[model samples]
Target: MSDLRRAAEEWLAQDPDPATRAELRDILDDDQALADRFGARLEFGTAGLRGELGAGPNRMNRVTVMRAAAGLAACLPSGGRVIVGFDARHGSRRFANDTAAVLAGAGLRPEVFADPVPTPVLAHFTRAFDDVVAGVMVTASHNPPRDNGYKVYWADGAQIVPPTDAEISAAIDRVGRVDALLLGAGWLVHDGAGLYLDAVSSLNLGTPDPGLSIVYTPLHGVGRDVLLAAFERAGFAAPAVVPEQAEPDPDFPTVAFPNPEEPGALDLALALAADRGADLVIANDPDADRCAVAVPGPEGWRVLTGDEVGGLLAEHVLRETSGDDRLVVTTIVSSSLLRSIAAAHGVRFAESLTGFKWIMKAGGPPDVAGERGGSSPHRKPDRLVFGYEEALGYSVGDDRGVPVADKDGIGAALAVAALAAEARQGGRTLLDLLDDQARRYGLHATAQLSIRVDDLSLITAAMNRLRAAPPARLGGCAVESFDDLSHGEDGLPPTDGLRFRLAGGSRVVVRPSGTEPKLKCYLEVVLPVDGDIAADRARAAADLDALRADVAATLS
Candidate 1:
């Protein structure tokens, strides 16, 4: 037999699922398919394993999940408790069970959520307990129906970062075949939803005024119950749930991609919002770790960019909460408006590399009492008030330091509802608050130019080309400065990205997508509001459009 055939047969032998065995059997005669499957495994990393589900190591399956669990077991302290949760995705439950089995077999206590839960709930459970060492969430967030993932949250309730991710990957490499690994089950079932809901209830900044009507959708994932429960607990009237997507469906029939950020994903919810005259429309991605908001305007209903939502929420948080040591954090690619928001409120602000892990790991208040999780013991601790990324991920820290170290769409929805209620009661809307921010701080407009490629080498080549000869001008504006982020600047760890600061207070950051096969270029335009929100917004939009085109051309 050929080497590929031999490997395929070997994988089929240990594969627990009869479905995958059949899949591998049929692919054995097809060299291309076999090569795709066995050529490369989905190596675990900071985000853990995520890929199309199939029979091979390259795909997410029982064997792959078990091996990853074993590797995780090796890195954790023996006998430590590990909690496991899953979303309503195909193979999610099985993969989660496999993970629990592996951890239990490795002599650690394993607690499995009895039902499908949102990603944020699992992270909350991971952090709620003092003894829980880490967590595994079986979900791909908003990936396509055919995909699944394994996400690891450390003791801090944040996604595993750097050295830990690297360590787990190395350990996975040493793991033997699944058949050789010991497995155990009958683990304790955890009440993650109940605990998470109560915690989220405490996040509501203000009483939800009855005047603020809202519509919500989970995009056919497992957030409906939790979101509804949270809304009720926060004193908000039950949001009109999109009936078509109210139930969990692994197929995600409503949208091509389950992500709320994708176009048309919110069409059903927006239509419902219109029917109910909802003041706001909220959506959580498949696993509910990200939240997307839509608002009605003179032009009709339009979804707000993550930055717009971030800005509006920041204003509400500042108004509702008090603390001179309060700190907020954002990513290099997110809008810079947050820094201004924090500063204007006499609060501290910090920036971190992309991802909620780094955001949660950000430095804390400079030596103030009552703050729990400020990194940089060397630097005085700053209480983290809030953190967000441009990708619809926000962590709104409550009175008790940051509860969910990772993004909590459920908590954010409550915050959005509370803020929207305040706006409605004050005879304003979310859009008005956004405009008010523009007037106080300069108008900050942001857009993204994402180019997906079939061949991964194209991304590497593009990165190389940009580095060899950086652009001196783009979007009719001179590039004021260029920084190769891979070399590490502004106290950020090394990462593969490029930053271009333009002369007109505009900027662009280009980097490969960490989760998808796309080159993502984040574009931002900053202009002082000229006392007219409409004209200022128009100019900002035009500038961003030109800049986006320039960036696309440069990258191509």
Candidate 2:
């Protein structure tokens, strides 16, 4: 009779999976469990649906996936074509097939991938096909083994933004009993693997040195075959792959978390790199959309931060490219070193709010005739030569060559390999190149202070506290100015975050994580290189440590 019981009963009746039906029935006797499962439906947003795989409206199951599919079908044009792709995750293939079936039933043409592929492959296909109205990628993308998700991309091969997401959400609200929706069969299946591989191979700027030894690991995801194929096509030697983490395993048993950015995720790869005496190490998250790189240093091997990788790649692309209309982009939280790099290279640069959605838009097509700019002062530039974020996401190719609208780990991996090989030819390492840049552009050091919390409200409380009473000084330097991003300022769109510029040119940006329960504070300090490179690096690193402490104190 209660609302919870009523919703559970309704969901159970339509759920085709016997396991979910049994799950709901067993939890019916426990009020807390029932309420948690049916308390509210998972809200589909621009990123699409992502949650733990289980029963009930709040979880990711056949019924929830079916409803989402039906909603997406209703939102699209009557006869538009849709592309569906999935990774090797629990229930991913089932979810992808369900989406295709639902779209087919809605009188829309649905083309599903023949096998599990990377997320970037889906993004590429969505853009390559002129008839594709939208794209649905069923993957959690770097999340743990127990979770699965659905990501939606528009005709531009980018994730759905603004009004589009809202419109699709409204259509989803109208979706009723899953049983009422016809589950069609015999949808068209397409093999986009070759197309994706070719696109990745095209990103190779020139012939890489054949003797460049490398180590790679997919972290038990689906990136191995695609990356290897790309490398081979680019004329690079076959990389020695980490045997334990080479294949796609839904359980992701080796790593505590599937994301490469997490600590210990690349242990196996690093060990293999040392044993093989490789020149470089590359890793991709479970879905293979994000790439991480590591290099051997004076103190063994160390992973480069996303900021470091962005700077190195930007410089490499700019040096190889020649033109007046060249453009590079990064987020506000990313290191300011990119701005310096762009200016030095005589290329235009812009900063966007966090996320690839804004970064890709800023890196517009070759023609910006009728497109209007966004709140960021650097919106919709003349030509987007390169775009990257601090979270290991990069789009190397422009509109003409590869046409990958989203981050491509495969492309980034190829680029990194080529850069390492070229550096080797110069009798230098990747770290040497980065150090040289620091000397020219002043030592730009960065660190992060991330505090994970069990209770979500703690994050909101921290943000409120910082805004109410801003910090006056950080790292013993006077704060010059503070900008609250909520109301929008400095040409940036309204976002919930704070930015501070210290008198000594140091910077800090604090905000709550959009996808996780945590408060992240990005800290940076710029120290002139002077004459001594080693001493300058030491001093800069120490200053960054001090700045990190000060910001952490403010958050606490």
Candidate 3:
């Protein structure tokens, strides 16, 4: 028999789900389908397993989940404790339960959430308990309806990276005989939602005005109850929720993609906001880990970029609280305006490669250690006032209170509401505040050029071409410096990317998407606001368009 057929047969024999067994049998006659199913196993990297929910080892099913759980369990110390939570996605609860059972069978303690919850809750709880060895959040944040994922967090409450992910992958390879694995009922089940909601409520800055009109939507994922409860606890009036999108529906019928960043994803919420005459609109991704905001702009309701939100929140936190050692963090691809804001407030600023895992490890260990299995001791864990990425991920407050080392939509939403209320009291809107910021700090216009390709090699070829022949000028500005991130620079660990600084105070960074098959080029142009702020903004916008076009051509 062929290798693909043999692997399929083996998988079919051990698969407990009758539906998957039938699926494999039906596809056996098609060689391409069989190879697609059994050609290779789904990779469990630092991000853990994420794929379409279907049969075969290449897909996300019970057998794949079981082996992943067993492999993760093998990486922990004996008798260690684990926390498991799931979102309201197809097969999410079952995956969480399967993970708990596998951990329990490995002689470890497993605490499983009774129902669906946000991904940040799992990250918070993982850090709250010292005895907790790790956490498993079963979700596919903002993916299509037919997809599900498994995310692993270590004891420090950050996503797994490097040596740890590799070690766990090795352990998974040693797993044998899915039928021989044990499944039982000794694990503990608890209401993680309550704990998470209570923690989210504590992030309230102050008593918000009772009459602030707001609109919110979870986009058919599980965030409505917790977000509403948080609003009430923070002393704000109940928001006018998008009735159709309030409930948690795994199918996510309303939107083509569940991510708030996607175009038209927030149309329903915007309509509700317009009808209610609301002050602002807040939206969370399907798993409620990333927050997006929309406000009434001159040209209708416009959603703010992740960089704008990051800058605003950084300013809010700095203004509300005062400390000598306060710090702010963002990714390299994010707008440089944050550095100016941080400097004006005397807050230290830092930049990471691209992900929250590196941003959260700020002031921690310099490199990944094999045996310790967690972040190096933070020099001042309490000093992390705020951290964010261009992908709408924010970590706010001190570790002792919030304990969230990952992106948090609930906490960010609460902060946005409070800021809006304060702005209203001063006879100003969010757009007004943004205008003031642009005047004080130069107008920083940013754009992204993302090219998606069916063949993965296209991305590799583009990167190689850029590296071999670096552009001399971009958008009529001469290139001043070129730094290849692969060899490491400016105290950052080596990563696969390139950064170019233009003579006219513009910048560009090219890198591959960590999760998608796309090559993204981030462009920014900083124009000084000399006279009319509007004219400066217009000029900056035009300059950004030219820069984007030039960069796109260079990549082509």
What is the C-alpha lDDT profile of model 2 across 203-285, one tens digit per residue? Answer: 64655988999999999999999999989988999888899998899999999999999999999999999998888999999
List runs of model 1 lying over 4 Å from the truth.
364-380
lDDT of 1: 0.89
What local distance difference test score does each model get? 0.89, 0.86, 0.85
Alpha-carbon TM-score of each model against the true structure: 0.97, 0.95, 0.95
lDDT of 3 by residue, 37-131 (tens): 78877888878989988988779999999999999988899799899989999999989988888889888899998889988888888887889
What lDDT, from 0 to 1, does candidate 2 have? 0.86
Positional deviation of residue 528's Cα in model 1 after best superposition, in angstroms: 0.8
Error of 3 at 137 (Å): 0.2
The sequence of per-residue lDDT tens digits that candidate 1 reaches over residues 25-106 is: 8878999999999998998889899999998889999999999999999999998999999999999988888999899999
Model 2, C-alpha of 410: deviation from truth (Å): 0.5
